[model samples]
Target: MTDPVDRDSRVPALVRLTVDLSALRYNYRRVASVGERTAAVVKANAYGLGAARVVETLRREGCRDFFVATLSEGVLLRAVDREATIFVLSGPVDEESAFAMVRHALTPVLNDATQLQWWRAHRETPAAVHVDTGMHRLGFDYRSFSASIFEGFNVGLVLSHLACADDPPHPMNERQVARFESIRSLFPDAVGSLANSAGALSGMASGMTRAGIALYGGNPFVTRPNPMATVAVLESRVIALRTVAAGEPIGYAATYTTAQETRVAVLGVGYADGFPRGATRDARVAYGASRLPVVGRVSMDLLHVDASTVGREIALGDWVEIFGHTIGIDEAAAWSGTISYELLTRLGGRVARCYTGS
Candidate 1:
């Protein structure tokens, strides 16, 4: 059997993902400038950009707090930084999980009565309380708010999620904020956190702001232009080029046909590499200044780009930017009929991830 390391050294990766730590730090500063205590939400492995590296970068920028979706995610992050406060958004599910959280010095964000009781029974260490302010996903409902239940408990933080913060004009934002304020008042001693990435950018944060997607260069708002710096750049190399006669079909099921004699470049990336297969609608890849529209459906291992404009300038092994400084991630996500969060997190493991600008 061939050694994997030796095989890797012999063959070059077709697709590459470059993460800019400097840009991540810059984004952290931008989110922190929102006038609230900023807590880095490094959940989903920092949105699949590698949690350990992202956490290290954020720590250097003076980020002391971090949030993760699960207890296991918190445990993994705890291994990255011994000092940074890690909050488990899913909280403890049972006794064993609660013990693990206490052992790792992870703070659980109690969402419901069961989690709160679990935390109270196992440990007295400070934990956060999540109040449901209209998202209806997690957190204790506002109608059931009771200060007595947390009388002897050390509630260190009170947070609520914003569902429509991305849609700034949505009336739900104001309503959720109002409900969160009422619930937060009940826990006067605990720190109040009511904003996410979009909320922080739009000046809706309070005591603490949980910055998620925006820190990774994803536009938090739906319509507003992305204000954050670019952090991740995805690129693929051209493996083959061919000339197709007019009326010839290309790719599986012949979804796209050559309207005229056209030059096509076969990229060494596809849905298997996290390039959305459904992005063929209006998706284009960048080669220098020329934008080559993607024609035909994206396959598992390859996709064809209409390189007629670039002509002879394009050659085999030339790299094309899938999304990066030249093409915005949000724009790419739109082409995929998805959101930036999905696009970033869906990046497959086969794609090489390189860290830069540290």
Candidate 2:
């Protein structure tokens, strides 16, 4: 019936997210090995792992092309890398954004007719052209797109998003490739591209594949093993210990009850720290090879884990591995009913990012 002790500063922050720069660099090389050239997709703050550090690492490793989802992201990357090429996937919709792109020396990936005309008229340097093969999200439709649309413009590359490259055998893969091939032929002077992380991993992406999820070591192929290095380690601290009586209800809404006299270790991470809010039985924290299974419902600020398996070896301020070298991101994401990209990107800002092995 005593209050839980706070172990702030002793553990050097409640949560520590370690990013392996060496692994990231290796992933870049692996992706580039498939395509002659590679464009690093660093959108969403490098999938919420800090784009500045990621960009600097890639730049040092000989990466020249970078892709971001917005003009602001492009500007942020431009500050980090002075000489590398920055491509804005989400092109400017207004005249001011186009001016910002020119001023920042960011290349816009023109998708629609409006973006096309704006870049055609205002772009001082070169810009990429996106033709819609099948994604139907961005890019111009190839059937209606004519050659005269890009006359006299400096088109650096023609790119398209694959609808089903992860499935490899999906008919959309061949269809998109064929369609993208025909579309890029009209602009023979421009470099052709039609792949993402999955495409790059499977060797389906041709001519300058843009890699996103795979860079952080997330498995791009569904049926095969993950070949990339472990680039990140998410961790939390054991704050309080309590003994729960058998059949005692635990956490919010009393979702779980202790099956026996159990030892519980409260961890300092929850929904606010990007751990799901309702991960009761499905979530588990790893301590070396042993798994500390989650016993109660997760909350906004904390989660409860059964430590009876560890006996008394676990103590206050001890670190618990959420996902790292031992636990794959895809495995953790699956337990949380989500994907690796969503899990990685949704990590809250409060967690401290510690880069290593640069």
Candidate 3:
């Protein structure tokens, strides 16, 4: 079937997202290596990489449990694998969605009394109960917590989210753990879970650990070495090249000026392509072993990078790695003062995705 990851560099894709499934699987094992029952969070289109393809790869690696944020995500996942455990993290809203959850055998992670009541009305399968730890985003609080809330339904998992799992020493981590432990203890029959990607590695997660961003090559530890292999590679084609003399202005409103005579490579990607409008630090692109600085304001469809350092070997249509095996997403995200998850999810649909290392 002509491999979907078009290895041919000649193909004219302005921007390409190379998803290394091998690295993804390796990352899965890396997170799983900590010995916690691991569940894959394949929400947000598997963090903007094609969920179907990524899930297919993970399934082969023996990942049977998956988590999604909404009914639509659960529905799409149900199409991918029928027997795998699919938990709708967002739970159900209306009667229709609750019924849809039952009909598909998809489990809902009940967050509040309304959702709990809604799921109970159409309970055909087991569901997860989310307890609020510290994020205050979803899950039940002390006011909502009651044995009667789960009285009649089958509770499969009792879980909570950590507001500061990325920062290991944060006091909120211990607080969430204590709260989550207390809630999980109330349900002896269901599996207890309180760790996310970072939680799993921290060795504090109980029962089952749910992994999200780390499974996709993101380093959950903000200040530590990324233990996982690089999984995502973003590359853009060099469509145009030019020479700008010293003090010459580049890009919109002359946001950047050339320090000396500089060669510029204008790539076919921009904020519209999920390249981060200006989140990049030093505004550089990778060429061979050299780093080319971005010399202008990032535009909607294009961005200019100074190639005077390695302009001799560069050519039109040659692919330049933006964030890849050599460049970590966290590193790039740091330059932009954002997290890897945001950069990964914010990646626009304009960029073509090609899976490799399957």
Candidate 4:
């Protein structure tokens, strides 16, 4: 059978990033039915999947709340949808950043006593207060945060981070839930939020749930499959195909030496394109219905795939799929010794993004 035409003829550059809008909407719908208001965490460029576009699409789907990592991120997101309820996860640090919030009407997630004090003294701005349940990254210290901080601040929401909710039965999960309960009791007026993607799946009771990785369909827990699991794999065209003799090496460092004559195809992706270095010769790329194994160490701009098994005439400009429906995000993360979040978010900005329907 002849393979279908898969190349995007308009911009036939070296590479591109394809985003499935339908899959995104599907994932959003799948997780939004938990009875809690879901906010799409588009911080880190929607985990490097093009934040602006994702936000616009989600907003059209009635997603009013959006979370970002920094004031700058909030500003960028606001440019997309000014009316969206945007929260800065990494609360402001200086007068300028704090002022940006008031000017833009962006809500900052106050993480500490200092931020609370700054907000109280400078302006009674609309803001969210984060409680440090277990993650030592950001949030107010429950022991040190004085009641005065809560007394005067215009708290729009009171939220906490879940340390091990992905592990469900982990002790930290219960401890955090208990602590958050106390916080809720203390600030009953403020909207309570504590569940992240994993915590949301844990069936925790919270007012708002932040779906970070799950919005992109990366597993919130281990590398297992479950509901709401999808992946956005990038497919680049193969510009060249050739046959190599036995004992011939592939890629940098001559890391992969062919045992026999091998047919290899050069694909348009590399470390610079967000295909991690470790994914080198061990990773797999797809061409139509054929699965091609990567050969040699991955380069900064390109890599080779062994297509010896497919005896058909493999031509140049064939589409090669990387890290999508076939290869889950968790599996791709394993090749990099990192988590699915990193892989999804760290996708280089150079790649062009195209979205499909759910």
**Considering every candidate listed, which one attains the maximal TM-score?**
1
* Backbone clashes (count) for model 3: 2
RMSD of each: 2.9, 4.8, 2.5, 4.6
Show where candidate 4 strays beyond 4 Å.
1-9, 229-231
Preferred candidate (TM-score higher): 2 or 4: 2
Could you tell me the C-alpha RMSD of candidate 3 in Å?
A: 2.5
TM-score, model 1 to reference: 0.95
Q: What lDDT tens digits, residue by residue, belong to model 1 across residues 102-221?
A: 999999999899987788775469899999988899999998788788878888999999999999999999999999999899887889999998998897978999999999999999
| Per-model CA lDDT versus the true structure | 0.89, 0.84, 0.84, 0.78
Stretch of 10 with least lDDT, candidate 1: 1-10
lDDT of 2: 0.84
Name the candidate, 3 or 4, with the larger lDDT value.
3
- Model 2 stretches astray by more than 4 angstroms: 1-11, 278-280
Candidate 4 deviates by what RMSD?
Answer: 4.6
**On residues 147-218, what C-alpha lDDT tens digit does candidate 2 reach at each position?**
787877788889999988767778888899889889888987888888888887776767888998889989
What TM-score, over all chains together, does every model reach? 0.95, 0.95, 0.95, 0.93
**CA shift at 247, candidate 2, in angstroms?**
0.9
Kindly report which residue pairs in candidate 4 clash with one another. Answer: 21-356, 22-356, 22-357, 22-358, 23-358, 47-345
Better of 1 and 2 by lDDT: 1
1-358 per-residue lDDT for model 3 (tens digits): 1222335666668999999998999999988888558889988889978888888888888888999999988887898788999999999998789999988889999988899878777654799988887788999994457766577788879888899998899999988888777777789899988889998887776678888989888898987788888889999999999988999999888878888999999999999988787655365679887888877888998979988888679999999988977677888887788878998888886778887898
